[model samples]
Target: MRKILTLILMGVAVFSAGYFFDKYEKNTCRAGVAYSIGNVDQKFNVSEEQLIEVASKSESMWEKAVGRDMFHYDPKAKLAVNLIFDDRQQSAINETKSREKIAALEQSYEGSFKKHESLTDQYKEQAKLYDELLSAYNESLNSYNSLVNYWNNNGGAPDDIYNDLEQKKASLSGQFDNLEIKRNDLNSLAARVNDLGKQLANITSTHNSNVDHYNVQFSAPKRFDQGDFSQNTINIYQFSDINDLTLVMAHEMGHAFGLEHITSSASVMNALMEGQDRSNLAITADDLNAVKIKCGYK
Candidate 1:
């Protein structure tokens, strides 16, 4: 009976050890990290659902690269992914707004320049036509005056000559009328050109002012870590857009997975955001190798 009891005790100990080891592996090793969306600041203008979707997408990158799951979403998970509103994010937001304003101002300035160019061209053409018309009017008037002077000096003119003078006077009057119309048109164009010039000046002033403001406020090179993992929580402080947010989240998730920063600039585990490809975020080979090493894979 004692021998049978010893064998049973050894079997119980073996089973218990195996059970706890399996649990440990699942919780801290092969099963990956579990995370959940926590505080999403309203200032971000994003919903928790949107964050979850992006987080899921980010997780899928690692999972797909390794052909296994690297993250799990659990409502009760200890890891809380938070979008915390702070000065970092506010600065980024302000920079974005300023850039947008500057872009709009630039567009307005370009449009005004094009309009000014076109109007200037029109003004030149009209001015040229007016000058030509004026020259023709002056030459015709001189000829008419010469003819009248000859008739007056001679004391009497033939009926045919008088009729010709009358016809010349009518033709000169018609030319004068045309010159008046052309002069008015040219004046109108000049006025329009002047108005546009003023408009362009105003736009330029505004654009320059905006540029100055941007330079004053946002020109400094800011290099802060956008997110961090600590105390079992991930705090996201700043991101330029949704893609940036995803890449930041992925970077933090790499930390949560017990991976360290890699030297490769293109790796998701890189220390700096400058080299990360936010648009086409994926786990590089370096990241995959790091994860494999961390999880005890060969």
Candidate 2:
């Protein structure tokens, strides 16, 4: 009787385990994990101001990374990878690859061999995790290649479609026990995100009247401003963003030209410039000449 009961329970456990794995395999990336640039194309309507800022920012970063050398209808440049907003951050600040962790990872890279002349269950667990990570890393590579191919064909696909790419990066990242592979993958994404950030920074810097020129970068909404440095550079924060910075572009240009912040919300140079007007993507002359003043009066 005892033996029969033991067999029944074992069977039940196996069935339950199989059912769970079936569910997991069917849904690889989970909900909200694989946002494609396809959806961003259909949605994401932006005002003119936002458009200029985004275009300028994206272009600037793309230019700086590989440079604008291959802009005239090049398929490869067009298909280059873009950073997802969620993946754009400073997470690496706390990132660590400790010595102990490194040694363990190195061991994982060698692949498991028998210890005590037997393959124990411990080996099985490590092997499973290693294989899972390897699969995920390959998937990311495939995804990047496909996107590049599409761009090279001039497919007009929007980039940054996967709104949750950052989150996905974290989860898929766990599959690799090899620290070097993990580090390289994480660094690649980090470098791309940093490149986007540099472009955004240019937008803010472009408005400084005090400096020869400034760089601006914009990716999100955050309350920030330049308290001083009005003597050397101008930093304008407009509920600052990537999508709608054209007006802020004008306002910053005004500061760059020697104009003080304006009270007239009606004026483009007004410190209180709103998004609607800014989205028009226009910069006024008063703002222009101030920059020209540094260049010499006509």
Task: Return the top candidate by TM-score.
Answer: 1
lDDT of 2 by residue, 34-71 (tens): 11111121122334344434435433322243222211
TM-scores for candidates 1 onward, in order: 0.82, 0.22
Q: Residue 111 deviation, candidate 2, in Å?
A: 57
Q: Lowest-scoring 10 consecutive residues by lDDT in candidate 1?
A: 217-226
Give the runs in model 1 whose Cα sits over 4 Å from its true position: 1-27, 212-216, 219-224, 296-298
Q: Model 1: how far is 138 from its true place, Å?
A: 2.2
* Cand. 1 TM to true fold: 0.82
lDDT of 1 by residue, 1-298 (tens): 9999999999999999999966865565667899988999999998999999989988998889888878999999989999999989988988999999889988988998899999999999889988988998899999999989998999967999999899999999999998898889889889999999999899889889989998998776444378999958999999989998999898898888777888888888888777777778888999999977767677
Q: Which pairs clash in the backbone of model 1?
A: none
Which segments of candidate 2 are over 4 A away from where they belong? 1-229, 236-240, 262-264, 285-298
Candidate 1: lDDT of 33?
91
